[model samples]
Target: MRPDYPLKTDRLVLRPFEEHDLDDLHAYRSDPEVCRYLYTHCATLEDSADRLTKTLTMSELTEEGQWLVLAAYLPEAGRVIGDVVLKWISEKHRQGEIGYVFNPEFQGRGLAREAAEEMLRIGFEDMKLHRIEAQCDPRNEPSWGLMERLGMRREAHFRQNEVFKGEWGDLYIYAMLDEEYARAS
Candidate 1:
């Protein structure tokens, strides 16, 4: 069952992952800087390959809180620089959660935001989601800042919420409701 994908933006195409993305995926996924906030650490080549293969099967959300992962493709550069994950947390609640990762080289280019904005559109306008939220390590200024810049309000700052990479890490939750999205537009 292929998930409908290839969502596009001005500078990106959010499509399904592919075997060809192995090198690029490993390049970033294996970087400590990139995996700092993620649950897992730097991945080996086999790990990256396995991860990519798993992503290829998850192109759409499921009823049981599964993620619909999309590859962030830069057509001009002709490469996969990152990926986006939109998890369907609750169909009854119409709630969703989003996450993203991009190559460090593309950090300041606003590509993630652009791609994320499109995902927001997909959640709100297409999927009929009532709420969309994002959570990140409070130390990850870039991630939380990007969420705020996307018009999501800071809902909570949980202190020492989880033991991440050994030590407890604080978390920040950002969200935008459907009505809020409507008001923003």
Candidate 2:
């Protein structure tokens, strides 16, 4: 139930994050454009390093559940270009959330979609999670579209749910059930 540990797609390798991934993560995560719609403030190299270290060690630090933070790597370059994370929302409820971020340079190439599909398959089939949810800022049309393409239904729209960069922002929730995925497949 450790969320399949690692997931893979045709052109991408999805594996657990490592400390060595910090520098590569800093390259894109520190960019303003990449963090814009993600509601993430700009990150310095140090900040990215901190985040990478924390993500890499989260599982070891916890005793109950394993939260997999995976890096998406290209086969040709053998470099990480994105990350996908599955966080256990509650052990009792058996609920979890899925999140991802990709380098802008690699956007629109279906890399995110491929990685997401792989993660979804693992989440539903291997993890046995009852509900898998994804949230995004409403302004991020592409991300919303990606959720739709993944067959997740828009379950909720919370207006002004968060304040980011001095302004209120809307958050859209998309969810898929294991049964729903099974039926779709």
Candidate 3:
């Protein structure tokens, strides 16, 4: 199993989803700007609640492909500003996947990266993952750039391989192996 939640970075607290986080979570998940690269369109309040409800049951995943979603809490702001997700993709392969979303209001800040770096530490050091990968829309520069900043290499760029939000979208995959992470650390 992975480490317990509330994983902290210098300026952010990454905690498991809670019953009361609906409003703060919805604020960003519902924003077109924030959901641009996400599979679903902007969320409704009910959609946010349903999403959070699913995450609440996912503090840890004993099975492959199960995901754990954590809220990115900003203490100074006293509210949730985003979320990070880590999926146990293949225990046999010791592989996992990571994803994230943040309010546009918080985009310029490095809070998302701060939270994501901690997730990497947990997946690599605590969970003993051999590799962690990430996929993002190629047009989402901020998203893929953040992955690069985390020391992951651009492993692939599939051309217009899938439709997202009713439109054709390209994809970029970034990944880092455990040995690479160890050397970087």
TM-score of each: 0.95, 0.90, 0.96
23-109, model 2: which lDDT tens digit per residue? 778878988887897766788888898889878755321322566678898887778998887776766675777888888888898
Residue 44 C-alpha lDDT in model 1: 97
lDDT agreement with native, every candidate: 0.88, 0.80, 0.89
Over the stretch 22-96, how does candidate 3's per-residue lDDT look in tens digits? Answer: 999999989998887889888999999999998988777678889978889999999999998888899999999
**Which predicted model would earn the best lDDT?**
3
lDDT value for model 3 = 0.89
The candidate with the higher lDDT, 1 or 2, is: 1
Candidate 1 displacement at residue 58 in angstroms: 0.8
Deviation of model 2 at 180, angstroms: 1.2
TM-score of 3: 0.96
